[model samples]
Target: MLTDVKRTPGEKAFDWLNLIIVLVITFIILYPLVFVLFASMSDPRKMFDSPLLFWPKGFNLDSYVTVFENKDIWMGYGNTVLYTTVGTFINIMMTVFGAYPLSRKRFYGKGLFTFLFTFTMFFGGGLIPSYLVNQQLGIVNTMWVLVLPGAISAFNLIIMRTYFQTQIPLELEESAYVDGCNDYRLLYKIVLPLSTPIIAVMVLFYGVGHWNSYFEAMIYMSDRGQYPLQLILREILIKNEFKDMLGIAVDSQYADRMIVREGLKYAVVVVSSLPLLILYPLLSKFFEKGILVGAIKG
Candidate 1:
C-alpha cells in the first residue's frame, strides 16, 4: 500500500512560486508569436491604432492570400520540402553508418576517429574556400550541394553512438552473431528495428535544420528557381518584392500594397515555421526519450 505524503508549508509555497514563474515565462515566450499572428491577421491601420495587441484588430487575411497566390512561393515551398526530406534522410543515414561502427567494441582506432569527427565541430574551412570547392565540383546550384555536404553532423553522431552503446546490449549482439548474423545483417535486421526513438529524434533535429536553412542556399544557389523556402521567404521579407504576387494592377493604390505587405510580413514567418511547430509535437515524446537515453549513460 502507498501512503500519501503531505507537503511542508515551505514546499507548498515553493510549488506555487514555481507555477507563477512558469506562467510568466510561458507568457513571455509566447507573446511574440501571438503578437505576430495577430498582427498578420489584423487590419494594418487598426492593428497599429490598437492600444493592446491582444487580439486581431478587425480581422483581415489579404496578406495570406497574397502569400499563397504567388507561384514562386509554391515553387519555393516544393523545393524546401524536397531539400528537407532528402537532407534529413542523408543526415540520418550517414550518422547511423558513422555511429554504428564507432559503437562496436571491435572497431579499430575508435578514439582517434571520434576525435577527428569532434575536431570538425570546432574547425572548418571558411566560406570562401568551401564555395570554391563546391564551384570546382560543379555542384554550386545543384540539389546535391545542399544535401550532401552536411550529411553527417558530428554532435548527432556522438549522441547516436552513445545511444547505441548504452541502449543495445552486448549480449544481444553476441546472440545475433551466434545465429550467424553478420554485422550488416545485425544492423539492418535487429539494431535499426529497435532504434526508432533515436531515429525519430534524429529526424526532428535534421529536418528542422534543413527546413530553416537559408544562408547555405543563398550562397550556393544562384538560380532563383532552385532557392529553398527560407531563401525565398528571406527575399520576400527583406526586399518586399511581391509585385509579382499582387493580383492588383501595377498602378494599384499604394495603400493596397501597404495592406498586403503588412500581412505578408508575418504570414511568411507563419508559413515557414508552422510545419516545424507541428512536427515537434508529433516527435516530442520520442525526442525526450532518445535524448535522455543518450545523455544518461554518456
Candidate 2:
C-alpha cells in the first residue's frame, strides 16, 4: 500500500509563480515570430488597420509569391548556398588545424602562440588597413575574399582547443603512436571521429555566419552577381520601402502598394530565417552538449 503526501502551501505557491514566469517569458519570445508569420499571410490593408494582430485576418500566399517573383532572390539563394558550403568547410579545416597543435602538449612555444592568437581577438588593424591589405592581395571583388580572411575565428579556435584538451585523452594519442600512426593520421582518423560534437557546433556557427553575412559582401563585392542572399534581400527590402514611400508621397491611389510592401517585409524575414530555424533543431542536441562540455568543462 502507498500513501499520498500533501504538498506544503509555500511549495505550491512557488511552483505556480515559476509557471507564471515561464509562461510570460515564452509569450514574450514567441509573440514576435507568430505575429510576423500571421502578418505576412494576412491582408496588408487589414494588417495596417489593426496593428495588434493575434491572428491573420485573411490568409493568402500573395507575399510569398511576390518574394519568389524576383530573379535576384533565386540568384541570391544559389550564391548564399555556395558561400556557406565552401566557407564553412574552410572554417572547420582551418580551425581544427590551428586548434589541434595548440592542444598538443608536445608543441613548443604554445603559450606564445596562444597569446598571439588571443591578441588578435581584442585588437586589429581596423577596416581601412584590412581593406588595403585585401586590395594588395587582389582578393577584393572576388569570392575568395569571403572565405579566406575569416577562415578561422579566434573564439571558435579557443573553444575547439579546449574541447580537444579536455575531452581527448593524451593516452589515446600515445596508443595511436604505438600503432604506427603519424600525426596527420591520428588527427584525421582518431581525433576527428571523437570530436563530432564540437565539429557540428563549428559547422552551425560558421555556416550560419556565412549565410547571414552582408557587411563583408557589401564592402568587398561590387558585382551584384556575386552578392549573397542577405545582401540581395537587403537591397530588395530597401527598394520596396523606397517605392512605398515614393508612392505614398506622389498619390493616395498608390497606398495599396504600401500595404503590399508591409506584407513583403515579413515574408522576406520568414524566407531568410527558414533555413536557420530548420538547421538549429537538427543541431540542437550536439550544440548544447558541445558548448557545455567544450567551454565549461575546461
Candidate 3:
C-alpha cells in the first residue's frame, strides 16, 4: 500500500558508500572512548599486560569506589553541578533575549548590535585585563566568578538567532500580534514553544563548557574549596601524576602508591565523564532537526 520510495543505481551506490564511510568514522571516534571504559573496568595490572582497546579483562567497580572515596572529588562534583545547572539557566535566558531582538528586522540599531556581538567572537580582552576587571568587580575568589563573566557565548547567541529567524514563522508572530499579544507574550508563548530543540542544543553546549572548565577557576578562584571538578581532576591527573611518569622506582614506597594512584586517574575520568555521557543521548535527540533549522534555513 505504501509506495513512495525510489532509488536509482547511482543513488544505491552512493548510499552504500556513505554507509561504509559513516561506520568507519563512528568506529574511529568511539574506539578511544571504548578503550577508556575498558581501562576503567579492568584490573590495572592486567591493563598494563595486554594494554586493552576494545574490551575489559576481569571487570570490576573498584576504581569507581576509589574515585568516590575522595572527599575532594565529591566536593568538586557538587560545585560542578551547581555551576553547570545555574550557568545553563543564565545561558538560556541571555541567549534567548539576545537572539530574539537580533532576529527582529524591525528593531532599531539591529545591525550595530549584531556587529558588536560578532566582534567579540574574534577577539577578547587578554587574560590579565579580564583578571583585573574581575578583581575590580570583587568577583575574584568568589563562586560568582565562575557563572557570571562568560555567561553568554556569542556563537551560541548567533546560532539561536539564526534558528529563531529560520524556523519560527513570521506569520505566527503576526497572528499573535493581531490577537493583542505584545512582543514579550509572543516570545514567551509562541516562539519558546517551537524552540525546545534549539534550547536543548544551547543547554548541552553551555553545560558541557561550564562543567569542563578549569583554567577560569584556576585564575579566578584562589580558594580550593570553591574549585570546580575539572580543576581538581587536573591537580590529581596531570600535576601529581606527571611526577611519577618517568617510571617511578620500585624501591620507593611512595612510587608504589603513585602507581596505584595512576589507576585512580582512570577512575576519575569515568567519574567526571559519566554525567555528560548520560546527558549526551538525551541532548542528541534534539540535535538533528535543530542543526538543520539553525544552519540550513535562509
Error of 1 at 240 (Å): 1.9
lDDT of 1 by residue, 56-119 (tens): 8889887788788888889999999999999999899999999999998989999999999999
Global lDDT of each model?
0.89, 0.89, 0.85
Among all windows of 10 consecutive residues in model 3, the one with the lowest summed lDDT is: 241-250
Better of 1 and 3 by lDDT: 1
What shift in Å separates residue 243 of candidate 1 from its native position after superposition? 1.9
Per residue, candidate 2 scores C-alpha lDDT tens digits across 66-167 of: 778777778889999999999999999999999999999999999998999999999999999999999999999988999999999999999999999999
* Residue clash pairs of candidate 2: none
Q: How accurate is candidate 3 locally (lDDT)?
A: 0.85
Q: What alpha-carbon RMSD in Å does predicted model 2 have with respect to the real structure?
A: 2.5
Best-to-worst ranking by TM-score: 1, 2, 3
lDDT of 1 at 52: 62
Q: Score every model by TM-score.
A: 0.94, 0.93, 0.89
